[model samples]
Target: MDLKGKTIAILATNGFEQSELEVPRDRLKQAGATVHVISPTAGEIKGWDKKDWGRPVTVDKTLDQVSSSDYDALVLPGGQINPDLLRLEPRALSFIKEVFNAKKVVAAVCHAPWLLIETGIAKGRKMTSYKSIKTDVINAGAAWEDSAVVVDQGIITSRNPGDLEAFSAKIIEEVKEGRHVQRNAA
Candidate 1:
């Protein structure tokens, strides 16, 4: 997975799933990609573990400081609060739109598919998410699956933390494939 020139943006906010963000960040970095932790706030963002608050991850850039074109791919980590908060932010939604418009990979896992739905990009896309949100994705026009990971066009999704291994591998594969010209706007 030679991604030497690739840049990935991990978008999150307070309450992001700790493992969902950290695991992929490390894996992508090891695969030779520069991963930026972009958030709605600067300084740092707290993460959510299984039941309580987890460690804080420093913010590399705030939403207002960067554009989607700055990166080769976008990653949205899911935790109940993270996606719920991001779905309401106009800037975050716009950033997501721009990335998809550029035909770059947009990877989400677990509840992160909520962000995809809000961007209106989930329509007709094949994806997998935390089982609790399967209906949500389907209602958004997505074809939901129960698999550990699913990639359609440049959109990649997985079920939950247990699926992170497959999730990370699929992301690396998609990034290596670069743009997907078949991806249509939502």
Candidate 2:
């Protein structure tokens, strides 16, 4: 789909799954969207490959540099460490909530849904995540699914790296569709 002139934000920090961030960010940019990698840390953040540390992604904007209004969509790329660190960050969670409340699309893959849970935005949404976190997602009040990708009122989620293509495609679709009336806004 055409995303020319759209600005998307990928929020991540050290230890994020390398492919999760890279694949989707690259896909979005290629689709003609202006994608920004935002992070709590300025400069760069490390990525976690399957077994070892992978490459680092440059942070286009620090958390304090932009507001939710600055983005058309927000993406959370999960790794065991990245979301774990971000979920506890008040600024990060607040920025996510602002984006959510604005009815903008928010996408998460793998364990990234943890950020949604921490922000109280996962409650009552239909979503999916890395299998290991199924219980955590259910506990957060989401009607969990086992599909490769799930979209509920503009909040998109997927299971793992294997699902990245679909996850990224859905983000573009949702953004092209514009804002959704979030049925269960936190």
Candidate 3:
């Protein structure tokens, strides 16, 4: 999918899965979209490697400085700490809600869907996330699936880092479509 001229916002804090954020960010940039990393703080956010923490990524903007209308899509990368921190930030949660309310595409991987649950936007949506989160997703009113990638409405979710290939592909597709496909009447 071609994303030329599109802007994607990644909302995260410390402990984001290194590859989850890096891989998709690089891929999105390669697809011709501008990627911005935003968080509640102004400096850099640390990433979590498989066994240990990884390097820090510079934050492009603070949650207070971002508006859902400023970007075409939103991405939330998961690491235990990343989404945990994000869920507690009122501004961050509010920003996420704005994205959903605007009907913009939202792509979340692994534990990141925790933030989606916190935003209360998963009601009646189908999605997938890290295995450990299946119960949480279901409790939030979402139908949890075990697929490599699941797309419901404009929301795209993946199981884990192993699912990045499918996750990345779905993000590109959703961004290219620029709007969610309405469910057909059963």
Candidate 4:
């Protein structure tokens, strides 16, 4: 029930879904893990609430300052803009790929699976995402489902903010179980 010595990284830039990022970060920390808000920028990143921009969350480190090996897990909080913007960054895709290859737990919510798609890790996993991007997920070869949370190997995904509790709980559970084996690796 505790993550006393774990370190988790929440990767995002501006336009993340507010609750999707905050809820898990706070919950993970309260469970005794050290969580860092890593972004493409150093300073603060603003989030997107339902209809407009939300408050800013401070960045603990920039993408260039950290490595995937230092983390036990990586989280990607989704908002339409956040994942779209991140998809355009080569470094972000590379970082995600590194994390996956290292077999660390990677949790994404809402539209965040867009990242897993970009990294090619979604090709054979069972996953879920905000309904709007269900096709994109399927196109990426993921076995998409409509569940609140879907985990295949080390990747954990949820539909939207409405699934936060389950999503966070699944992450905590998976992290505690430690890294996964790449069952279908080529």
Candidate 4 wrongly placed segments (more than 4 Å): 184-186
- Quote the positional error of residue 166 for candidate 2 in Å: 0.6
lDDT of 4 by residue, 3-116 (tens): 999999999999999999999999999889999999988999999999999999999999999999899999999999999999999998888888888888999999999999
Shift of residue 19 alpha carbon in model 4, Å: 0.3
How many residue pairs clash in model 2? 0
User: Per-model C-alpha lDDT, please?
Assistant: 0.94, 0.94, 0.89, 0.93
Clashing pairs in 3: none
Candidate 2, 140: how far from true, in Å? 1.1
Model 2 local distance difference test score: 0.94
* Ordered list by TM-score, greatest first: 1, 2, 4, 3
Misplaced by over 4 Å in model 3 are: 181-186
Task: Give me the displacement of residue 70 in model 2, in angstroms.
Answer: 0.5
Worst 10 residues of 3 by lDDT: 177-186
- lDDT (Cα, tens digit) per residue for candidate 2, span 65-129: 99999999999999899999999899999999999999999999999999999999999999999
lDDT of 1 at 22: 96
Model 3 over residues 96-154: C-alpha lDDT tens digits? Answer: 88888777899999999998898887778898999998999999999999899999988
